[model samples]
Target: MNATDPLLTVEDLNVRFPTRQGVIEAVRGTSFSVGRERVGIVGESGSGKSMTGRAILRLVRPPGEVSARRIDFMGEDLLSLSEREMRRIRGHRISMVMQDPKFSLNPVIRVGEQISEAYRLHTRASRRAARQKTLEMLEAVQIRDPERVYQTFPHEVSGGMGQRIMIAMMLIPDPDLLIADEPTSALDVTVQMRVLAILDKLVQERGMGLIFISHDLNLVSSFCDRVIIMYGGRIVETCRAAELDKAEHPYTRGLLAALPRLDQPQARLDVLERDPAWLKEQSVVAHV
Candidate 1:
Protein backbone atom coordinates (compact mmCIF):
# COMPACT_ATOMS: atom_id res chain seq x y z
CA MET A 1 0.00 0.00 0.00
CA ASN A 2 1.08 3.55 -0.65
CA ALA A 3 2.12 5.84 2.23
CA THR A 4 -1.13 7.79 1.71
CA ASP A 5 -3.13 4.68 0.91
CA PRO A 6 -4.76 4.02 4.26
CA LEU A 7 -5.62 6.09 7.32
CA LEU A 8 -6.43 2.85 9.14
CA THR A 9 -4.85 -0.53 8.42
CA VAL A 10 -5.16 -3.96 9.97
CA GLU A 11 -3.08 -7.07 9.31
CA ASP A 12 -3.58 -10.48 10.92
CA LEU A 13 -6.12 -9.15 13.46
CA ASN A 14 -7.45 -11.90 15.66
CA VAL A 15 -10.05 -11.61 18.44
CA ARG A 16 -10.90 -14.43 20.81
CA PHE A 17 -13.22 -14.97 23.74
CA PRO A 18 -12.05 -17.63 26.13
CA THR A 19 -15.06 -19.42 27.52
CA ARG A 20 -15.27 -22.49 29.76
CA GLN A 21 -16.27 -24.41 26.64
CA GLY A 22 -13.40 -23.28 24.41
CA VAL A 23 -11.88 -20.30 22.60
CA ILE A 24 -14.44 -18.62 20.35
CA GLU A 25 -12.62 -16.65 17.71
CA ALA A 26 -14.77 -13.78 16.53
CA VAL A 27 -12.34 -12.17 14.07
CA ARG A 28 -9.62 -14.43 12.68
CA GLY A 29 -6.70 -12.95 10.81
CA THR A 30 -8.76 -10.15 9.28
CA SER A 31 -6.86 -7.52 7.26
CA PHE A 32 -8.26 -4.40 5.64
CA SER A 33 -8.23 -0.57 5.88
CA VAL A 34 -9.80 2.81 5.17
CA GLY A 35 -8.14 5.88 3.66
CA ARG A 36 -10.37 8.69 2.45
CA GLU A 37 -12.59 5.79 1.38
CA ARG A 38 -15.86 4.58 2.84
CA VAL A 39 -15.27 0.85 3.40
CA GLY A 40 -18.14 -1.42 4.35
CA ILE A 41 -17.77 -4.71 6.23
CA VAL A 42 -20.77 -7.01 5.62
CA GLY A 43 -21.58 -10.47 6.93
CA GLU A 44 -24.14 -12.51 8.85
CA SER A 45 -24.82 -12.36 12.61
CA GLY A 46 -21.66 -14.14 13.81
CA SER A 47 -19.25 -13.07 11.09
CA GLY A 48 -17.29 -10.63 13.32
CA LYS A 49 -18.04 -7.38 11.49
CA SER A 50 -18.80 -5.54 14.73
CA MET A 51 -15.93 -7.28 16.50
CA THR A 52 -13.56 -5.99 13.86
CA GLY A 53 -14.73 -2.43 14.58
CA ARG A 54 -14.28 -2.91 18.33
CA ALA A 55 -10.84 -4.40 17.76
CA ILE A 56 -9.81 -1.26 15.90
CA LEU A 57 -10.86 0.86 18.88
CA ARG A 58 -9.45 -1.62 21.44
CA LEU A 59 -12.87 -1.79 23.06
CA VAL A 60 -12.85 -5.58 23.44
CA ARG A 61 -13.23 -6.58 27.10
CA PRO A 62 -11.14 -8.92 29.27
CA PRO A 63 -12.54 -12.23 28.07
CA GLY A 64 -12.56 -10.95 24.52
CA GLU A 65 -8.88 -10.51 23.70
CA VAL A 66 -7.64 -8.61 20.60
CA SER A 67 -4.23 -9.36 19.16
CA ALA A 68 -2.68 -8.27 15.89
CA ARG A 69 0.78 -8.20 14.38
CA ARG A 70 0.01 -4.87 12.74
CA ILE A 71 -3.02 -2.70 13.42
CA ASP A 72 -1.83 0.71 12.35
CA PHE A 73 -3.92 3.88 12.33
CA MET A 74 -2.51 7.10 10.89
CA GLY A 75 0.92 5.37 10.90
CA GLU A 76 0.75 4.77 14.73
CA ASP A 77 0.63 1.25 16.15
CA LEU A 78 -2.81 0.89 17.77
CA LEU A 79 -2.06 -2.44 19.45
CA SER A 80 0.85 -0.94 21.46
CA LEU A 81 -1.06 2.05 22.92
CA SER A 82 -1.74 2.15 26.67
CA GLU A 83 -5.24 2.48 28.12
CA ARG A 84 -4.69 6.13 29.02
CA GLU A 85 -3.25 6.92 25.58
CA MET A 86 -6.02 4.97 23.83
CA ARG A 87 -8.61 7.00 25.77
CA ARG A 88 -7.14 10.19 24.34
CA ILE A 89 -7.28 8.77 20.82
CA ARG A 90 -10.60 6.91 21.04
CA GLY A 91 -13.29 9.62 20.95
CA HIS A 92 -11.05 12.66 20.55
CA ARG A 93 -9.30 11.46 17.41
CA ILE A 94 -11.54 8.55 16.33
CA SER A 95 -15.24 8.13 17.16
CA MET A 96 -17.83 5.39 16.90
CA VAL A 97 -21.58 5.37 16.21
CA MET A 98 -22.80 2.28 18.01
CA GLN A 99 -25.61 -0.08 16.96
CA ASP A 100 -28.56 1.50 18.77
CA PRO A 101 -28.92 5.18 19.49
CA LYS A 102 -31.12 4.52 22.53
CA PHE A 103 -28.40 2.41 24.11
CA SER A 104 -25.59 4.73 22.99
CA LEU A 105 -27.27 7.95 24.15
CA ASN A 106 -27.75 8.63 27.86
CA PRO A 107 -31.37 8.29 28.93
CA VAL A 108 -31.54 11.08 31.52
CA ILE A 109 -29.03 13.65 30.34
CA ARG A 110 -30.05 16.31 27.84
CA VAL A 111 -28.80 15.38 24.37
CA GLY A 112 -26.93 18.64 23.98
CA GLU A 113 -25.00 18.08 27.17
CA GLN A 114 -23.76 14.69 26.02
CA ILE A 115 -22.54 16.03 22.68
CA SER A 116 -20.99 19.05 24.35
CA GLU A 117 -19.20 16.82 26.81
CA ALA A 118 -17.56 14.93 23.96
CA TYR A 119 -16.36 18.21 22.44
CA ARG A 120 -15.09 19.44 25.80
CA LEU A 121 -13.18 16.24 26.38
CA HIS A 122 -11.27 16.58 23.11
CA THR A 123 -10.53 20.31 23.32
CA ARG A 124 -10.02 22.72 26.19
CA ALA A 125 -13.34 24.41 25.48
CA SER A 126 -15.68 25.94 28.04
CA ARG A 127 -19.22 24.59 28.43
CA ARG A 128 -20.56 27.53 26.41
CA ALA A 129 -18.17 26.92 23.52
CA ALA A 130 -18.92 23.19 23.53
CA ARG A 131 -22.65 23.91 23.52
CA GLN A 132 -22.29 26.15 20.50
CA LYS A 133 -20.34 23.49 18.61
CA THR A 134 -22.84 20.82 19.67
CA LEU A 135 -25.79 22.80 18.33
CA GLU A 136 -24.01 23.42 15.06
CA MET A 137 -23.26 19.72 14.72
CA LEU A 138 -26.92 18.91 15.36
CA GLU A 139 -27.98 21.39 12.69
CA ALA A 140 -25.53 19.86 10.23
CA VAL A 141 -27.27 16.50 10.68
CA GLN A 142 -30.50 18.23 9.53
CA ILE A 143 -32.28 18.43 12.87
CA ARG A 144 -35.15 20.90 12.38
CA ASP A 145 -35.08 22.48 15.83
CA PRO A 146 -31.58 22.26 17.27
CA GLU A 147 -32.46 24.26 20.40
CA ARG A 148 -35.51 22.18 21.32
CA VAL A 149 -33.87 18.93 20.35
CA TYR A 150 -30.84 19.84 22.42
CA GLN A 151 -32.96 20.05 25.55
CA THR A 152 -34.89 16.85 24.82
CA PHE A 153 -33.71 13.68 26.52
CA PRO A 154 -32.85 10.63 24.46
CA HIS A 155 -36.22 8.98 25.20
CA GLU A 156 -38.05 12.16 24.29
CA VAL A 157 -36.68 12.20 20.74
CA SER A 158 -37.79 9.86 17.98
CA GLY A 159 -35.51 7.04 16.78
CA GLY A 160 -34.42 9.07 13.73
CA MET A 161 -33.48 12.12 15.77
CA GLY A 162 -31.82 9.98 18.41
CA GLN A 163 -29.57 8.42 15.77
CA ARG A 164 -28.91 11.86 14.33
CA ILE A 165 -28.00 13.08 17.79
CA MET A 166 -25.63 10.15 18.13
CA ILE A 167 -24.04 11.18 14.87
CA ALA A 168 -23.68 14.73 16.17
CA MET A 169 -22.03 13.56 19.37
CA MET A 170 -19.62 11.34 17.43
CA LEU A 171 -18.75 14.03 14.89
CA ILE A 172 -18.46 16.90 17.40
CA PRO A 173 -14.81 16.04 17.98
CA ASP A 174 -13.98 16.14 14.23
CA PRO A 175 -12.24 12.80 14.47
CA ASP A 176 -9.96 11.41 11.76
CA LEU A 177 -11.93 8.16 11.54
CA LEU A 178 -15.47 7.09 12.43
CA ILE A 179 -16.55 3.50 13.02
CA ALA A 180 -20.32 3.36 12.59
CA ASP A 181 -21.49 -0.06 13.71
CA GLU A 182 -25.04 -0.57 12.40
CA PRO A 183 -25.61 3.09 13.24
CA THR A 184 -28.99 3.45 11.52
CA SER A 185 -30.24 -0.14 11.62
CA ALA A 186 -32.92 0.60 14.22
CA LEU A 187 -34.59 3.38 12.26
CA ASP A 188 -37.32 3.08 9.64
CA VAL A 189 -36.31 2.68 5.97
CA THR A 190 -36.88 6.34 5.10
CA VAL A 191 -35.01 7.47 8.18
CA GLN A 192 -32.20 5.06 7.50
CA MET A 193 -31.57 6.60 4.10
CA ARG A 194 -31.53 10.08 5.57
CA VAL A 195 -29.11 9.10 8.29
CA LEU A 196 -26.80 7.50 5.72
CA ALA A 197 -26.93 10.64 3.62
CA ILE A 198 -25.93 12.71 6.62
CA LEU A 199 -22.95 10.47 7.30
CA ASP A 200 -21.88 10.49 3.65
CA LYS A 201 -22.08 14.27 3.50
CA LEU A 202 -20.18 14.81 6.74
CA VAL A 203 -17.45 12.38 5.73
CA GLN A 204 -17.01 14.11 2.39
CA GLU A 205 -16.94 17.56 3.95
CA ARG A 206 -14.31 16.55 6.48
CA GLY A 207 -12.32 14.23 4.16
CA MET A 208 -12.44 11.68 7.00
CA GLY A 209 -12.31 7.89 6.64
CA LEU A 210 -15.33 5.73 7.57
CA ILE A 211 -15.75 2.06 8.37
CA PHE A 212 -19.46 1.22 8.09
CA ILE A 213 -20.12 -2.17 9.64
CA SER A 214 -23.39 -3.96 8.88
CA HIS A 215 -25.11 -7.12 7.54
CA ASP A 216 -26.89 -5.33 4.74
CA LEU A 217 -24.97 -6.23 1.58
CA ASN A 218 -27.27 -4.33 -0.79
CA LEU A 219 -27.03 -1.19 1.27
CA VAL A 220 -23.26 -1.41 1.35
CA SER A 221 -23.07 -1.98 -2.40
CA SER A 222 -24.79 1.30 -3.18
CA PHE A 223 -23.61 3.49 -0.29
CA CYS A 224 -19.95 2.59 0.15
CA ASP A 225 -16.98 3.04 -2.15
CA ARG A 226 -15.56 -0.42 -1.41
CA VAL A 227 -17.09 -3.51 0.17
CA ILE A 228 -15.41 -6.19 2.29
CA ILE A 229 -17.52 -9.34 2.42
CA MET A 230 -16.70 -11.41 5.48
CA TYR A 231 -17.89 -14.89 6.43
CA GLY A 232 -16.94 -17.23 9.24
CA GLY A 233 -14.86 -14.48 10.90
CA ARG A 234 -12.70 -13.79 7.85
CA ILE A 235 -12.87 -11.73 4.68
CA VAL A 236 -14.17 -13.76 1.77
CA GLU A 237 -14.06 -11.07 -0.90
CA THR A 238 -13.25 -7.42 -1.55
CA CYS A 239 -14.75 -5.49 -4.44
CA ARG A 240 -15.65 -2.02 -5.61
CA ALA A 241 -19.22 -0.85 -5.03
CA ALA A 242 -20.03 -0.67 -8.74
CA GLU A 243 -18.57 -4.13 -9.30
CA LEU A 244 -20.72 -5.85 -6.66
CA ASP A 245 -22.93 -7.24 -9.40
CA LYS A 246 -19.99 -9.32 -10.62
CA ALA A 247 -18.74 -10.51 -7.22
CA GLU A 248 -17.33 -14.06 -7.51
CA HIS A 249 -17.45 -15.36 -3.95
CA PRO A 250 -20.19 -17.85 -3.17
CA TYR A 251 -21.00 -16.03 0.07
CA THR A 252 -21.26 -12.65 -1.62
CA ARG A 253 -23.45 -14.05 -4.38
CA GLY A 254 -25.61 -15.80 -1.80
CA LEU A 255 -26.19 -12.54 0.06
CA LEU A 256 -27.16 -10.77 -3.16
CA ALA A 257 -29.57 -13.58 -4.07
CA ALA A 258 -31.35 -13.33 -0.72
CA LEU A 259 -32.30 -9.68 -1.18
CA PRO A 260 -36.01 -8.96 -1.85
CA ARG A 261 -36.94 -6.97 -4.92
CA LEU A 262 -40.04 -4.98 -5.88
CA ASP A 263 -39.70 -5.02 -9.65
CA GLN A 264 -40.39 -8.70 -10.12
CA PRO A 265 -42.86 -10.85 -8.24
CA GLN A 266 -40.97 -14.11 -8.19
CA ALA A 267 -43.03 -16.94 -6.75
CA ARG A 268 -39.94 -18.34 -5.05
CA LEU A 269 -36.63 -16.56 -4.73
CA ASP A 270 -33.69 -18.84 -5.32
CA VAL A 271 -32.02 -19.01 -1.94
CA LEU A 272 -28.24 -19.03 -2.15
CA GLU A 273 -26.44 -22.27 -2.95
CA ARG A 274 -23.93 -23.05 -0.24
CA ASP A 275 -20.70 -24.67 -1.33
CA PRO A 276 -18.51 -26.85 0.86
CA ALA A 277 -15.49 -25.39 -0.94
CA TRP A 278 -15.55 -22.05 0.93
CA LEU A 279 -15.76 -23.81 4.28
CA LYS A 280 -12.83 -25.99 3.24
CA GLU A 281 -10.80 -22.90 2.39
CA GLN A 282 -11.52 -21.44 5.84
CA SER A 283 -10.38 -24.63 7.49
CA VAL A 284 -7.09 -24.55 5.60
CA VAL A 285 -6.48 -20.92 6.58
CA ALA A 286 -7.35 -21.66 10.21
CA HIS A 287 -4.86 -24.49 10.39
CA VAL A 288 -2.12 -22.27 8.94
Candidate 2:
Protein backbone atom coordinates (compact mmCIF):
# COMPACT_ATOMS: atom_id res chain seq x y z
CA MET A 1 0.00 0.00 0.00
CA ASN A 2 2.91 2.38 0.69
CA ALA A 3 4.33 1.84 -2.86
CA THR A 4 7.93 1.60 -1.52
CA ASP A 5 8.64 5.27 -2.19
CA PRO A 6 10.08 8.33 -0.47
CA LEU A 7 7.02 9.55 1.41
CA LEU A 8 7.23 13.34 2.02
CA THR A 9 9.53 16.34 1.49
CA VAL A 10 8.80 19.78 2.95
CA GLU A 11 10.90 22.80 1.98
CA ASP A 12 10.89 26.41 3.18
CA LEU A 13 7.47 26.12 4.82
CA ASN A 14 6.00 29.04 6.74
CA VAL A 15 2.85 28.98 8.87
CA ARG A 16 1.32 32.01 10.55
CA PHE A 17 -1.69 32.59 12.77
CA PRO A 18 -3.41 35.98 12.57
CA THR A 19 -4.73 37.25 15.88
CA ARG A 20 -6.02 40.61 17.04
CA GLN A 21 -2.95 40.88 19.24
CA GLY A 22 -0.43 40.16 16.49
CA VAL A 23 0.59 37.78 13.74
CA ILE A 24 2.42 34.79 15.19
CA GLU A 25 4.68 32.96 12.79
CA ALA A 26 4.26 29.40 14.00
CA VAL A 27 6.56 27.72 11.44
CA ARG A 28 9.39 29.80 10.00
CA GLY A 29 10.58 28.37 6.72
CA THR A 30 10.93 24.82 8.01
CA SER A 31 12.08 21.91 5.82
CA PHE A 32 12.35 18.18 6.34
CA SER A 33 11.54 14.82 4.76
CA VAL A 34 10.66 11.28 5.71
CA GLY A 35 11.77 8.07 4.08
CA ARG A 36 10.66 4.59 5.21
CA GLU A 37 12.19 5.19 8.64
CA ARG A 38 11.58 6.94 11.93
CA VAL A 39 12.32 10.67 12.39
CA GLY A 40 11.66 12.76 15.48
CA ILE A 41 10.92 16.46 15.89
CA VAL A 42 11.74 17.77 19.38
CA GLY A 43 11.16 21.14 21.00
CA GLU A 44 9.73 22.80 24.06
CA SER A 45 6.25 24.31 24.29
CA GLY A 46 5.56 27.04 21.70
CA SER A 47 8.72 26.12 19.82
CA GLY A 48 6.72 25.38 16.61
CA LYS A 49 7.38 21.64 16.63
CA SER A 50 3.70 20.64 16.42
CA MET A 51 3.01 23.38 13.90
CA THR A 52 5.51 21.89 11.48
CA GLY A 53 3.76 18.52 11.62
CA ARG A 54 0.31 20.07 11.15
CA ALA A 55 1.58 22.11 8.22
CA ILE A 56 2.66 18.93 6.43
CA LEU A 57 -0.84 17.48 6.83
CA ARG A 58 -2.44 20.84 5.90
CA LEU A 59 -4.34 20.57 9.17
CA VAL A 60 -3.88 24.18 10.22
CA ARG A 61 -7.28 25.70 11.05
CA PRO A 62 -8.74 29.03 9.94
CA PRO A 63 -7.00 32.15 11.27
CA GLY A 64 -3.86 30.07 10.73
CA GLU A 65 -2.46 30.25 7.20
CA VAL A 66 0.11 27.72 5.93
CA SER A 67 2.34 28.78 3.04
CA ALA A 68 5.29 26.81 1.82
CA ARG A 69 7.42 27.41 -1.24
CA ARG A 70 7.34 23.64 -1.72
CA ILE A 71 5.73 20.68 0.07
CA ASP A 72 6.03 17.41 -1.82
CA PHE A 73 4.74 13.96 -0.98
CA MET A 74 5.33 10.98 -3.24
CA GLY A 75 6.33 13.39 -6.07
CA GLU A 76 3.13 15.43 -5.52
CA ASP A 77 3.10 19.01 -4.20
CA LEU A 78 0.77 18.89 -1.21
CA LEU A 79 0.28 22.65 -0.93
CA SER A 80 -1.03 22.67 -4.49
CA LEU A 81 -3.64 19.94 -3.89
CA SER A 82 -7.32 20.71 -3.45
CA GLU A 83 -8.91 20.14 -0.05
CA ARG A 84 -10.89 17.27 -1.59
CA GLU A 85 -7.71 15.71 -2.91
CA MET A 86 -6.04 16.14 0.49
CA ARG A 87 -9.03 14.53 2.16
CA ARG A 88 -8.63 11.46 -0.05
CA ILE A 89 -4.92 11.26 0.74
CA ARG A 90 -5.41 11.82 4.46
CA GLY A 91 -6.05 8.59 6.44
CA HIS A 92 -5.57 6.55 3.25
CA ARG A 93 -1.94 7.07 2.33
CA ILE A 94 -1.09 9.40 5.23
CA SER A 95 -2.52 9.30 8.75
CA MET A 96 -2.01 11.37 11.88
CA VAL A 97 -2.24 10.20 15.49
CA MET A 98 -3.22 13.20 17.56
CA GLN A 99 -1.97 13.73 21.12
CA ASP A 100 -5.21 13.05 22.96
CA PRO A 101 -7.39 10.12 21.95
CA LYS A 102 -10.48 11.31 23.87
CA PHE A 103 -10.72 14.60 21.98
CA SER A 104 -10.16 12.87 18.64
CA LEU A 105 -12.54 9.99 19.40
CA ASN A 106 -16.29 10.44 19.15
CA PRO A 107 -17.73 10.34 22.62
CA VAL A 108 -21.14 9.14 21.42
CA ILE A 109 -19.76 6.56 19.01
CA ARG A 110 -18.32 3.20 19.91
CA VAL A 111 -14.54 2.89 19.49
CA GLY A 112 -15.00 0.16 16.90
CA GLU A 113 -17.40 2.36 14.93
CA GLN A 114 -14.93 5.22 14.92
CA ILE A 115 -12.15 3.03 13.51
CA SER A 116 -14.52 1.32 11.11
CA GLU A 117 -15.55 4.75 9.91
CA ALA A 118 -11.89 5.39 9.16
CA TYR A 119 -11.72 2.14 7.20
CA ARG A 120 -14.96 2.97 5.38
CA LEU A 121 -13.61 6.34 4.26
CA HIS A 122 -10.90 4.60 2.21
CA THR A 123 -12.46 1.23 1.40
CA ARG A 124 -15.80 0.02 0.09
CA ALA A 125 -16.09 -2.71 2.70
CA SER A 126 -19.18 -4.20 4.22
CA ARG A 127 -19.95 -3.45 7.84
CA ARG A 128 -19.04 -6.99 8.73
CA ALA A 129 -15.55 -6.85 7.17
CA ALA A 130 -14.73 -3.47 8.63
CA ARG A 131 -15.86 -4.63 12.06
CA GLN A 132 -13.65 -7.69 11.71
CA LYS A 133 -10.62 -5.60 10.79
CA THR A 134 -11.30 -3.21 13.63
CA LEU A 135 -11.15 -6.04 16.13
CA GLU A 136 -8.11 -7.49 14.39
CA MET A 137 -6.34 -4.15 14.70
CA LEU A 138 -7.04 -3.98 18.43
CA GLU A 139 -5.57 -7.45 18.82
CA ALA A 140 -2.62 -6.51 16.64
CA VAL A 141 -1.85 -3.63 19.01
CA GLN A 142 -1.82 -6.19 21.85
CA ILE A 143 -5.07 -5.15 23.41
CA ARG A 144 -6.59 -8.08 25.27
CA ASP A 145 -10.19 -9.18 24.58
CA PRO A 146 -10.78 -7.33 21.34
CA GLU A 147 -14.54 -7.83 21.35
CA ARG A 148 -15.07 -6.13 24.69
CA VAL A 149 -12.73 -3.29 23.82
CA TYR A 150 -14.27 -2.86 20.38
CA GLN A 151 -17.74 -2.06 21.66
CA THR A 152 -16.48 0.22 24.43
CA PHE A 153 -16.92 4.00 24.28
CA PRO A 154 -14.22 6.55 24.96
CA HIS A 155 -15.24 6.91 28.61
CA GLU A 156 -15.50 3.17 29.06
CA VAL A 157 -11.79 2.63 28.46
CA SER A 158 -8.76 3.67 30.52
CA GLY A 159 -6.30 6.28 29.27
CA GLY A 160 -3.85 3.59 28.14
CA MET A 161 -6.58 1.71 26.31
CA GLY A 162 -7.65 4.90 24.62
CA GLN A 163 -4.14 5.54 23.34
CA ARG A 164 -3.91 1.97 22.07
CA ILE A 165 -7.23 2.42 20.26
CA MET A 166 -5.88 5.56 18.62
CA ILE A 167 -2.87 3.62 17.35
CA ALA A 168 -5.17 0.89 16.04
CA MET A 169 -7.28 3.40 14.14
CA MET A 170 -4.27 5.11 12.59
CA LEU A 171 -2.65 1.83 11.60
CA ILE A 172 -5.84 0.23 10.26
CA PRO A 173 -5.33 1.72 6.83
CA ASP A 174 -1.61 0.86 6.85
CA PRO A 175 -0.69 4.44 6.02
CA ASP A 176 2.51 5.10 4.11
CA LEU A 177 3.54 7.81 6.56
CA LEU A 178 2.29 8.47 10.10
CA ILE A 179 2.62 11.87 11.75
CA ALA A 180 2.42 11.17 15.47
CA ASP A 181 2.06 14.50 17.21
CA GLU A 182 3.07 13.66 20.77
CA PRO A 183 1.32 10.31 20.41
CA THR A 184 2.06 9.09 23.94
CA SER A 185 2.05 12.39 25.78
CA ALA A 186 -1.18 11.68 27.64
CA LEU A 187 -0.16 8.23 28.83
CA ASP A 188 1.60 7.60 32.14
CA VAL A 189 5.28 6.72 32.25
CA THR A 190 4.76 2.95 32.21
CA VAL A 191 2.16 3.12 29.47
CA GLN A 192 4.31 5.52 27.49
CA MET A 193 7.06 2.92 26.98
CA ARG A 194 4.53 0.27 25.97
CA VAL A 195 2.91 2.54 23.41
CA LEU A 196 6.33 3.49 22.02
CA ALA A 197 7.15 -0.20 21.69
CA ILE A 198 3.94 -0.80 19.77
CA LEU A 199 4.81 2.05 17.43
CA ASP A 200 8.34 0.74 16.90
CA LYS A 201 7.02 -2.72 16.02
CA LEU A 202 4.50 -1.29 13.57
CA VAL A 203 7.08 0.87 11.79
CA GLN A 204 9.55 -2.00 11.57
CA GLU A 205 7.04 -4.62 10.42
CA ARG A 206 4.97 -2.41 8.11
CA GLY A 207 7.90 -0.53 6.54
CA MET A 208 6.24 2.89 6.91
CA GLY A 209 7.89 6.21 7.71
CA LEU A 210 7.08 7.90 11.03
CA ILE A 211 7.35 11.54 12.03
CA PHE A 212 7.38 11.52 15.83
CA ILE A 213 6.88 14.98 17.25
CA SER A 214 7.44 15.45 20.96
CA HIS A 215 9.20 17.50 23.67
CA ASP A 216 10.58 14.47 25.46
CA LEU A 217 14.26 14.44 24.52
CA ASN A 218 15.04 11.04 26.09
CA LEU A 219 12.12 9.34 24.44
CA VAL A 220 12.84 10.78 21.01
CA SER A 221 16.54 9.98 21.33
CA SER A 222 15.73 6.33 21.85
CA PHE A 223 12.69 5.96 19.58
CA CYS A 224 13.76 7.75 16.41
CA ASP A 225 16.54 7.35 13.83
CA ARG A 226 17.27 11.08 13.38
CA VAL A 227 16.35 13.92 15.69
CA ILE A 228 15.34 17.47 14.67
CA ILE A 229 15.49 19.96 17.50
CA MET A 230 13.43 23.10 16.87
CA TYR A 231 13.79 26.44 18.60
CA GLY A 232 11.85 29.65 18.03
CA GLY A 233 10.05 28.16 14.99
CA ARG A 234 13.23 26.87 13.39
CA ILE A 235 15.32 23.70 13.42
CA VAL A 236 18.36 24.18 15.66
CA GLU A 237 20.04 20.83 15.25
CA THR A 238 19.83 17.53 13.41
CA CYS A 239 21.66 14.37 14.41
CA ARG A 240 21.44 10.60 14.59
CA ALA A 241 19.58 9.22 17.60
CA ALA A 242 22.74 7.76 19.07
CA GLU A 243 24.64 10.97 18.38
CA LEU A 244 22.18 12.96 20.46
CA ASP A 245 24.65 12.47 23.29
CA LYS A 246 27.09 14.49 21.18
CA ALA A 247 24.79 17.05 19.51
CA GLU A 248 26.86 19.94 18.05
CA HIS A 249 24.55 22.95 18.19
CA PRO A 250 24.57 25.12 21.32
CA TYR A 251 20.78 25.02 21.59
CA THR A 252 20.88 21.25 21.35
CA ARG A 253 23.57 21.04 24.02
CA GLY A 254 21.44 23.24 26.29
CA LEU A 255 18.41 21.03 25.70
CA LEU A 256 20.40 17.96 26.65
CA ALA A 257 21.57 19.76 29.79
CA ALA A 258 17.97 20.60 30.64
CA LEU A 259 17.07 16.94 31.02
CA PRO A 260 17.20 15.86 34.69
CA ARG A 261 19.58 12.97 35.14
CA LEU A 262 18.91 9.95 37.35
CA ASP A 263 22.41 9.37 38.66
CA GLN A 264 23.15 12.92 39.80
CA PRO A 265 22.24 13.42 43.45
CA GLN A 266 21.14 17.04 43.43
CA ALA A 267 18.68 19.07 45.45
CA ARG A 268 17.11 20.47 42.27
CA LEU A 269 17.56 20.33 38.50
CA ASP A 270 19.24 23.24 36.77
CA VAL A 271 17.30 25.16 34.14
CA LEU A 272 18.81 25.23 30.63
CA GLU A 273 20.64 28.25 29.23
CA ARG A 274 19.33 29.60 25.91
CA ASP A 275 21.76 30.99 23.37
CA PRO A 276 21.13 34.28 21.53
CA ALA A 277 21.97 32.33 18.38
CA TRP A 278 18.99 30.00 18.90
CA LEU A 279 16.82 33.09 19.37
CA LYS A 280 18.02 34.35 16.00
CA GLU A 281 16.79 31.08 14.37
CA GLN A 282 18.44 29.39 11.37
CA SER A 283 18.11 26.73 8.69
CA VAL A 284 18.08 22.96 9.35
CA VAL A 285 20.54 20.56 7.77
CA ALA A 286 19.36 17.46 5.84
CA HIS A 287 22.20 14.94 5.85
CA VAL A 288 20.21 11.96 4.64
Q: Identify the candidate with maximal lDDT.
A: 2
lDDT of 2 by residue, 1-288 (tens): 254456888888889988889998888877777889899999889999988888888999988999988889888899999999999888888988887865789899999999999998799789999999999999988899999988889999888888889889999998988999898887789999899999999999988999999999889998899999888788877778987887766667777776777786533334546643455554446464
For model 1, the stretches where C-alpha displacement exceeds 4 angstroms are 1-4, 263-288
Model 1 Cα lDDT, one tens digit per residue, 184-261: 787788998999999999999998899999988888888998988887788878878888887776667768877888
TM-score of each: 0.92, 0.92
Q: Report backbone clashes per prediction.
A: 0, 0
Q: Where in model 2 is the C-alpha error above 4 Å?
A: 1-5, 265-286
Candidate 1: worst 10 consecutive residues by lDDT?
A: 279-288
Candidate 2 residue pairs in clash (backbone atoms < 3 Å): none
lDDT of each: 0.84, 0.85
